[model samples]
Target: MASEILSTTDCETIVKNYLNRNDFEVMWYNLKPFFSEVNGFLGEHLLLLIDVKIKERTTTLRFFTKRFPFEHPMQSQYLNSMQGWQREIYFFETFLPNLERTLPGYSLDFVPRYLLGKPNDIIVFEDLTLRNFDLPRKPSLNLLDNQHICLAIKALAKYHAGSLAYEEYKSRELGKPYRLYSGEEELIKEPLIRKEEGFLGYDWFKAGVSGLRALINRVYKGEKPLEEVNAKFEILVEKALQLMFPHSNFRNVLAHGDLWAKNIMYQYEGDSSEPINVLLVDFQLQRYNVPIHDVLLFISLTTNRETKQKYFTFYLNYYYKEICNQLQSLNVSPEEVSMAYDEFLGSVTFIMPEIKIQGALQRLQQCGNKDFYTKLLGNKEEFIKFVFGDKTPFALELFDTDDNFRGLLTEAVEEVIESCLYPEIFREDCYRILEDTLGKSAYELKQYKTETIDEKEFLFKLEITVVIEKNEKEFKFLVQNKPLGFAKVIKKL
Candidate 1:
């Protein structure tokens, strides 16, 4: 294992090494960023696989990583996975390739290749250009249906099946216990509360950072409004970090610490009948977390009624069923899924209200750096506007991160399982309704050829199912060349 810390220049050198020789030619070098508001270690920047040329071969690749960042040196690293940070890394580095080789041909979907160089927290993987947005950072352009939700859940379960059996599948190759976040992040070298006031948010240039303008006066004085609330929010944030470790016992499983929709990929196959594959990207954030983080990230990030209503339950069931099927295929006794699920996510629901689904999604979609710069003088976007000609996109004053609705959804998923356990309870009418919505609204659905298996023929093809319009009342948004409405998912060949 070539495990030594790398610097920014080293990352560039390594990329050039790979590009100049066998597989690819360097086209564009993009710098990945981290969000200061969030965890420091969390990688917001990933190498965008632009063009590859090898052995008389040329190809194009694209996959996006949501720009999560770290603001100052004080930002603390945290975990959102069920198994926590430690397990997250373990699953990806250890479980991924091994599961593909072992386990009777069961597979998980994530970006194909990644680089583990130091310097600005770099991770590189397959570009899911075909797939739509992950729930968090979706530009309000794409729409998802029940099936889309289902496949996402299926992807989740398949992930669990591949990962849950880490020890049996390929434990020896599991280098360095790719578990919850333990490594130190250069950016976040300190804690939250102890940081200097100026580091809290950006200075109030246009309007300035909220919460703390006068540090000694307010922080020491115990400002009435924020003192109690800030204290509690900070505490919950820590709990959010701690929640990653579900059980100290079964610490071997792959967990996508940040499993929000932004990380999900959708290949629009133009056919509603075929099973649409949902692939994952961004692995630097991968760590040992409780399974619930995946579930929570997926459901909470993607289940905004804005995107699709009632998908909360739709996706949960999908994961459960897929997990069981994968186990059966691996001869691991399908029933063990419930036990695994139980192990990963029992006794932990309603931990804290999900930050409002939309608000969280917006945060997920944004780059931590822009969020960082905005805070410098306060108002990241406005700061950008101050710096440049175009103004940056800023959130509405009414944005809510309370997570009250998130809490509801979390409870609903865990409790609703009993009511909708049977397959019949899964709605056929729902699928029909989505098909109609998408079919009627599709201004033009273009099927794009996808090469699934590289050697022989195009493996999995996708159709660019871009819906031109939608019901404004249903899914509201401002699009450049489209109407308003919720987009549906159909797998028709």
Candidate 2:
């Protein structure tokens, strides 16, 4: 079936369309699988290395081809549900072209140049490897240096800024407001964060959370801080689902929802360790959300704790400044198009907990590679099922024995406790919510307690002394709390 899809005739058609001419003859061509099993989970990738002749000259061109892996019957249904093929087709054919036209003279080089696409099936891109852009040298694909981080942030900022510019351009041209996925079409209406079934659906997400909890429990067993964090897994899962979807309160941009190290390619100059250009790939999880969604995900997953502690503020400020520069280049005011630094920082703080949880889960999922799983579990299909089917024994085993995995998982829980749970901003937000709900000006948190109902549920009881005008009133409430703050006041006591 894949061969049929990329037959000689089909390849010629793709090439002709890309070159804008039918006069060329296909002299020679070769197709080789691209990426390893670890990186090729969603699609069947083929490097279409070809040589063609036209007007007495032979030209070589490399195109990266990706098609829905229908051959893997087990993953086909799941992949289809993700709508990656459809979304990527839309991005290459519709979204990028619009952006290119709108932001003329602005560099839209962060993404690979689109060549051709087949709706719901296959797409083609100019292979960036041929352009000297390659994945980071780190075997784990983590960006260790500040220069790499800076380049990534710059590219991301430009991409977000370009999306805003396109929206403004469309709004002016059509004499109305415009945004990505604003239309009622089925392709755009499909959500990546599906509650029922899909790659990032409730089932898969719960499985990840379950795996992380089991791993933490087994490895850290009676440790109090980790135990507390583990207790919040249920709440974190729900909170993550809520935070991942688009929120209306913040300034939104078309985010490359998956921005981890693997999806990014960098170009280097001579023998220098620093990169000159950063190119982003994989647009399947692209969504219209606040820019911080992508930024937080990238920083959390790609860098370790020390890098984050030393350079987190630097990265944030650099990204924000780049966004402003990009907006100004497009003749749009940064203040009008972007969130203020404080508000942006608040959004980051609000979403950090969910992001950390997601980073851990993503790493857990990545552990289900063919080499690792097959060697340990013997059956790849069964291993995959266990990884995504709300089973965790295999993942727990990996976490227990694998030093790198243990380190990453341990760090995630540590971050969740140190950076997410105990932050002053988090506490302030909790108190602020209580104040708003009770119509009080201020609240002194007298007692804050967490009750674990079962393995999958939690309740937060807050006893606060409310300052009503000049008087202090004591009250109790059963608060449905998220990591960000109190979700709601369930009842008053």
Candidate 3:
């Protein structure tokens, strides 16, 4: 394994040496990025696939080399604070392989195996795609449904259970706690908490809340006024951030910090819609945090509104049961470690609003970086504003059009409203907003492909039939061919 990045020629040389087969000849090889622009922001992903010929037999081999700061901007403070590809290298090299001894029955082999590991802030792994692993269709645009969600949750439970077992094994054998990554205890500290004020002063936290407020105000005008609850918003966001970090009372398991739908892959059992296996890629954001951190983030960010409404409790129970079962499989009692439903719900409720805010921004970001930057206008001071620009299309535009984003936002919004946990003022305010907009109404959204009005705008129409006050309100109106980033009553009667 090279400590530093190798050039094209150097990569070929290392490949030859690593293969260590004189009888084989490398036929053709190429390197490509593993993540698309939407799924990836940091780190340079160089996936190399090579074909080799040995004794008139030709076979192909694949390896993935991920180099941080390869082409991405390493200047942003938020991006810099997230620097830890090497931690993942440590995970794959020293920690993951022990799953066989730790939990012999469970299959924790979903992750890609490493061909080379860290020395110079880079790690290489065997590509799993060659084994027929694939991302969900329209991964960036689609919401993960219940079946796939279950698979992902189970996979995460197994990984967490394995980590817990590994920790026990290390204590028994090494006579001390095992550190999977260097300075892991310190490195895994929550980024939202600053030295003095905690998440209250964190820029990302502030930006997320501010962006949510702006979007709400713009979309749900004259209802759900959040101007006065600014301080309350900050407080709630702080509470949620606190819930994310590990405490002494809870068992700290490894969390896949960025657990969105895009980072996970699945393989089906021969033309069946049900997925038989799941794999989690992208460990750059790995941290030692509560399992709920991964669980909440994944569910909140990935599931659609309908899924959450129908199966939120079911999914939580599912994950909790899986955790208990997996730990018990390793002879650990569930009561001792499993997070109770009440505690889990508390964390989920507190964090849902904040996560929804993030989910919106991330969806808007998926529209395109170029569009976002244009709205940004080189104004770092107004970054949050840029993130919610009207001109810029966001996932919200697809709300009435696409079921996935809509279900996700709807579930998030409804969960927060149902909790009644927000400050009375904020809760009442938002409640009124929902009642005025969607109350007593069953809205079925419809879409039609229309002509472009001009180069700057496209002319599209959304039709909705809402039942309210024992009356049906149906309306079709033209929207200026853009992603409606916020919920606005275009023609509500």
Name the top TM-score candidate. Answer: 2
- Model 2 CA RMSD to the hidden true structure, in angstroms: 8.9
The model with the greater lDDT, 2 or 3, is: 2
Top lDDT model: 2
The 10-residue segment with the lowest total lDDT in model 3: 424-433
Tell me the tens digit of each residue's lDDT in model 2 across 103-130: 8777667888777777667788888776
Q: Each model's TM-score?
A: 0.47, 0.79, 0.67
- Scored by CA lDDT, what does every candidate get? 0.39, 0.68, 0.54
Model 2 misplacement above 4 A: 1-3, 7-9, 17-22, 35-39, 173-176, 183-192, 197-200, 219-231, 269-273, 367-378, 417-493
Q: What is the lDDT of residue 309 in candidate 3?
A: 41
Ranked by TM-score from best down, the candidates are 2, 3, 1
Of 1 and 2, which scores higher on lDDT? 2
Deviation in Å, model 1, residue 303 alpha carbon: 2.3
- Evaluate residue 397 in candidate 2 and report its C-alpha lDDT on the 0 to 100 scale: 72
